[model samples]
Target: MTAISTALPAMSRRDEIWHGLRDTFPMMVGALPFGVIFGTLATAQGLSPLQVMSMSLFVFSGSAQFIAVGLVTSSALWVIWAATFIINLRHLLYAANLVNHVRHLPQYWRFPLAAMLTDETFAVMELRYRQRGSEGYAHWYYLASCIGMWLNWNFWTLVGLVVGQSFPDLKSLGLEFAMVATFIGIVIPGLKTKPLWAAAITAGLVATLLHHLPYQSGLMLGALAGVGIGLVLDLRRKKLEASVYE
Candidate 1:
């Protein structure tokens, strides 16, 4: 309690934003290639420049929008819509986790911040909230981080669209490696404990085992399994700690 009390006040808005940007850079690397892919694919699928840009602005979700565009090209409207909704189901978890932190903000800020929240942004924010205990203007911190991600994503999307419109080989520019490297950087550090490792391996195996499931249901199931394993392990650990204290 004494340590938390002392540390909370020392963290200001500027410090929060600075650390948020630093923490967010690796994920931004992943977003760059993804944005380029979206831009090139949108052009290849015959969308106009305005429409291609609009997809980024309105949809704001990289994976969902990409899947949606593919479905659109194949005239699979209903399936695409369903898939988009499913891909975005993770946002519900984000919203639930962040509610206590951001609900105190005015509705205007809350709405836009929620709009900007992505998996990467949520992961960073969740760790921060867990560490810092949102006593001050934590919503501002979350927004600052979210804005960094949002602006970078839009900017790269614009660049991708322009390059896509001009060049044919833009997709082969070795952009895919950025995403792979970024994922490794983030996920490897996170595997510091046995529970985290167990959850990750379980999730991977479940995903591979059920890869044949249609409509991407396997992904949702795998995520559920991973979360359940983590929760059960965490609960058992807590019980052990409580017993030791007793």
Candidate 2:
């Protein structure tokens, strides 16, 4: 109903779609190598081509899928569940803004967009909404951006599968760090809140302290502790706000 790209003078629906794809380029740069690394390494870790590709298509979370692949054999299923859940908790923050943007749309529109939503999509979409203001067919931009990323991730994963089957040692390329870089780009800007910064620092510290633990259980414990602490602080802030309002 409203033009989300109000800032951009005038543009057609197709143009908006292309603009969404164009704007997501920088994010795709970071995701490209990460997807390849997952494709290459996941199979080596005992996942079949079907399973790996299914993860990209269905799970569709770069960090969480990587973690799942890494833990698929060594850790228990519960561990994989807990770890990926913690890793994806960051999406909650992203979803808050996302829901507000798409709240006006129908279920058909919102469901897929929310399902395929990622850190990169959220960041770019947030910027678009804030800078441009959603007034027209901005949902097309949102949808196009998401589809662009989804296709990019799936394509690279297939390439990794094809190439990794032949080479078997792409991990040695040190290309995995690209995702880490992408995460930093995602997190640093969002650390505007005290709870987020505190949780991040605490999670790292606790995980590092417990790094020597068996099955890497320390990482999960540390993450739990960080989440606990963050929730406490957030609740306290909410009460204070409510008291002030009263």
Candidate 3:
């Protein structure tokens, strides 16, 4: 009976991981072209295949990689690093939000999970945490999602790097639009609350107005603006609720 009980839990956890992978498949479809496009553009910008793959492997940040590529030629090394750092500041917010759930995990488990974190994985994992409330096995689900995205990104990156060698004009095909459309798909469904809608609008307007900013600093500014607005509104709502309860 003891052995059976242990085996049952293991089986259940495996099921959770499988579910996470299944849920992430849709997002992977969107990320596929984005990764390929990055690979294509990076090579066009004079990055060797090894360098391109290394960036994807080690950094695992889509926006930062893109920004780095743009700044690589004309900008100083520090400038490229700083631009990518600023653009990825939003990950801090994602980590803060998820800290409570993963804090109990050991360093071994937590480190890789943290390393694999990305915008798309965060979105899906956040939704899962809300629904399931971070029972111990949730990390396994997160792991599955992270691994799915990591593999998807690396695989498509290789595809792009190989194909780009033959067709130098591959980027001109406008396939990057797939990434934009995918983001729309991801963002629209998450706007269930007033704060979310307000934040999205604020960020969109700020980014659009500041689109000409160098090194994509506009994106960082827009993200900060949206987060600030959302936080203020959320706090005000909480204060109002507290007053009503009192």
Candidate 4:
């Protein structure tokens, strides 16, 4: 009985990791074109293949990387840095939502997991934690999702870099549209609540109207607006529930 009890936890952890990998497969597929496009565009923008791969390996942010590559020539170093920083502000919210669940984890586990956290991985982690509760080795499951995405991004980046060297016109191939479809897939499934729909519609309209803004500031503005709208609505709903109970 003692031996069985000891082994079961280990077995369960393995299962959690497996499930994490399995669930993130669709997101990985959605990210495939974006990774390849980033690699190709970075190289075409005069970044060496090593620099391109290094960005994917270390930074691991698809949108920020794309923006960086796009502005590498036209913008100053500080401007590029600031643009990427603004683009990644959403990760702050992602990390905040997860802090309660991961606060107890050791530094070693927390640091790498935090570094590897991305939109898709965060989505997978949030869904799993909602359904399974973060009781056991849930961090291992999060780690699995992160590692799968890291490997996939690197592999496709390499393929794109190599192929871009030969084709030179790879960007015109329309592969980037895959990323749009993928983002829609990620967002649509999560819009089950009224707050979500309001946020999405608000952001979409705001972004569309401000699309002419430089450095994609419109995107950031729209995101902030959406978040603000969602928060206010959520708080009001909570207050109404409290008053009803009273």
- Tens-digit lDDT string for candidate 1 (51-112): 98888887889878788777777766788888888878879988998888876688898889
lDDT by residue (1-246, candidate 4, tens digit) is 243423233337888889889999998998888888887888899999889999999999998999899889888999989888878888998999888889989999999999999999998988877766676888889999999999999999998899888888888878888878877988898898888889999998898899899767888899888988988998898999999999
TM-score of 1: 0.89
Q: What value does the lDDT take at residue 171 in candidate 2?
A: 78
What TM-score against the true fold does each predicted structure earn? 0.89, 0.76, 0.89, 0.90
Error of 4 at 72 (Å): 1.5
Could you tell me the lDDT of residue 98 within candidate 4? 89
lDDT (C-alpha) at residue 27 in model 2? 85
lDDT of 1: 0.81
Judged by whole-model lDDT over C-alpha atoms, candidate 2 comes out at: 0.86
lDDT per residue as tens, model 3, 1-246: 243322223337888899889989988998998888889889999999899999999999988899888878888999988888878888988999899989899999999989999988998988887766677588889999999999999999999899888887887888788878877988998899888888999999998899899767788789889888988988898999999999
lDDT of 2 by residue, 104-153 (tens): 89999988888988989998898888877775778899989999999999
Candidates 3 and 4 compared: the better one by TM-score is: 4
**Residue runs of model 3 more than 4 Å from their true location after superposition:** 1-11, 242-246
Residue pairs clashing, model 2: 2-135, 2-136, 3-135, 3-136, 4-134, 4-135
lDDT at 45 for candidate 4? 94
